[model samples]
Target: MSKSLLLLFVAVFCINCSSDNKESDTPPTEEPLYFPPLTGTTWKTKSVESLDWNKAAVQPLLDYLKLKNTKGFIILVNGQIVMENYFNGHDAATNWYWASAGKTLTSAMTGIAQQENLININNKVSQYIGTGWTSTPIDKENLITCKNLLTMTSGLNDATDDVTPSALTYTADAGTRWAYHNVYVKLQDVVAAASRQTWSAYFNTKLRDKIGMDGSWFASGNNSVYYSTTRSMARFGLLMYNKGKWNDDVILNESYFNEATNTSQNINLGYGYLWWLNGKASYHLPQSQASFQGSIIPTGPNDMFMALGKNDQKIYIVPSKKMVVIRMGEAADNVNLALSDFDKTLWTKISALYQ
Candidate 1:
C-alpha cells in the first residue's frame, strides 16, 4: 500500500480507537442506591432538600394518610427514616398485624428454606405437607407444589372461607390456575416439616434475628398473622431493597430473591411471589378472578414492588427511587382483603412530593 493509503487507514483506526475509548471512559450510570448499616436501630437519612424533592409536597400525604385512617406511616429514603408518623393512638412501638403483607415474609422464608437445601419449592406439597393436605383426589393433590403456593397457583378452590388443607377444594390442575389463597401459609408448614422446626422458630433464627427485625407470628383463628412495629416492617423492606443482604450477611440468595420479586407466572404480570409488582401491563385483584389492564400502583415508581395486605397495610420497596415506604392501619375507605384505591391515590400524592 502507498504511504498516503497507509496514512488514511491509520486515521480511520485512530478515529475508531478514540470512539471506543470515549465509550469506555463514560462513568457508570446507576444511581447511588444507598443501604444502611446492618444490626442497628440507628439508620441515616436523606432529606427532601438533599435528595432534590419538592419539600412542601409532603404535608398533603400526611393529611391524606390520616384521613384514610392510616395508623403508622413511614418513608425510608436510602435506608433512613426520612418521614415517620403515627396517628389514631398508634405509636412507633405499637405492634400491628401485617395481614397479607406478611405473606411476603412467608415467601422470603420459603426462599431461605430452599437456599439451605432443606426443601425444594418445586417438590410436591404432599411430599412435605403430606397427602390429604388438600381435599383434592390423591393424584390431583399431588400436582400441587410449593411453587404453586408461592405463585398463588395452587389450583385449590379459594371461593370458600375455610383455609385448611381439607377445605382446599380442587378446581384446576396446579400451575394452570392463579388464585390468591392463604394456601401460601401452607409454605410455613412445608418449611417446618422439611427443617424439623416450627415456622416461627425457623423464620426467627434464619431472618428476623439475623436482620435485627422485631416481630412475631400469632394464631389468628384459622390463620396466623405477623405483628411488628412499623419500623420493623420498614427493616424488612430495606432487606429486600438490598436483595436480601444485610451488610456482609447473605440472608437470602440473590437468585431466589430476584425470582421472588419478578413476575413468577404468566397468570399475573403484576405479581411476584406474594408481592405486588408495578409497571406490568396487567394486574389481578384479590377475591376477583378478573384480570385488569395496567400497573397496580400506576402513580408510583415503575420498579416498585410491595408486600401489600388487608386494610391497606403495605411495605413498598421502590428500587428506582432508593426508598422503602410502609403504611399500617385500618381499612382505607373500604374493608378489603388486599390492595385498594388507597394504593394509587397515596402514590399519586407521593409522586407530587417528588415532583
Candidate 2:
C-alpha cells in the first residue's frame, strides 16, 4: 500500500481509539438513591382500602382509640413488616411532629456530641455555658451538670419559661430530684452553641442523612420543631434497634446508644437519656396497664424504647423482638383531646396480630 494511504488509515485508527478511551474513562451514570426493599409489600394499604386487622375484638379497640383518624402505622417484626397501614388523608410522605417525643432525638444528638469530643453529658452544663447557669441563689446552680440535663434533673425553675429561658436559675441543687420540663430543651441550644452548628444542620449531617432518614427540623427549643414522615421516624427507630447502626451504617456511637436507651434517669419510672422504656412501672392509666410509656405501642416488647411527641407522634423500637412500631396523629391538646388511652388500645390490638 502507498505510504500516504497507510498514514491516513493509521490516523483514523488512532482517533477512534482515543475516542473510545475517552468514553471509557467518562464515569458511568450513578444509580438513583436506594429505596429499602419491601418484604410484605402486599400489606401496604391505601387510604381507601380497609385494613386487614380482622380480629373482631380489634374493632372496638379501634373505635375506642379513634384509629379511623390515625395518620399512619408501621409495624416491623424481626426486620420484616407484619403490618403497615395509612388512614384517610394520610400517607408516608406526610411529615409529623414529634413534640416532646422529639426529646429522644435530642438525647441521641447529645451522645453524638460526646462521641466527637464536642461535648460531654457528664460534664457540668454550667462549665460549657459558664456560671450564668447558676441559680438565683448561685450555689445551687453549680451543682447542675450536663448529666442533670440529660436526666431532666437540672433543677432549673422551668415552671415559667420552659422553651427559651433567658435566665436559667438552678432553683434547687441539681441531681436532688426529678422534673419533666422544657428546661432540658435549652440543652439543645447549649449543644448548638458548644458545637457551633444549628440544631437542624447538626442533626441532618450527623444523624438523619447518614441513617437515610428523610427528617427535617419540625420544631426546636419550643420554636424550631422538626417534622418527618412516618417512614423517616421508623428509620430512626430501626437505627436505634441495631444499636445506633442504620442500614449497616453506624450513625451514633454504640456506647451512647446503649446509654441513651438504658434506664438511666430515675424521675420517670420508664425514662432513659431521652427515650422512654417499656417498663409498666410508669403506667398512669388502665390503658397503660397493658401498654407502657416511652413507645407508640404499649403491647410492644419489654425491652423497647420510644420517641414520644405531644401530638401523639411516637417511634417505638424493641430490640429484643427486632420490631419498630410508629404512629403519628393530631393530639393538639385542642378539642380537649387525650390520646394516651387511645394509643394504649391501639397497641393492644396490634399486639394481638403479632401473637
Query: Residue by residue across 1-355, what tens digits does model 1's lDDT show?
Result: 9999999999999999999999999998954545555456676666778778888888898899999999999898877778899999999889999999999999999999999999999999889977887778999998888999999998989886577767989899999888888778888899999999988999999999887788799998667899999988988998999999876689999999999999999988888988889999998888778999998877888899999888889999998777899999999986576777788899989888787
Which stretches in model 2 have alpha-carbon errors above 4 Å?
Answer: 1-68, 133-135, 218-223, 280-300, 332-339
Tens digit of per-residue lDDT, candidate 2, span 229-278: 77777767776777876655667878888778776765455667867667
Per-candidate TM equals 0.89, 0.74
Residue pairs clashing in model 1 are none
Output the worst ten-in-a-row residue range by lDDT, candidate 1: 30-39
Q: How close is candidate 1 to the true structure, as a TM-score?
A: 0.89
- Alpha-carbon RMSD, each predicted model: 6.5, 13.2
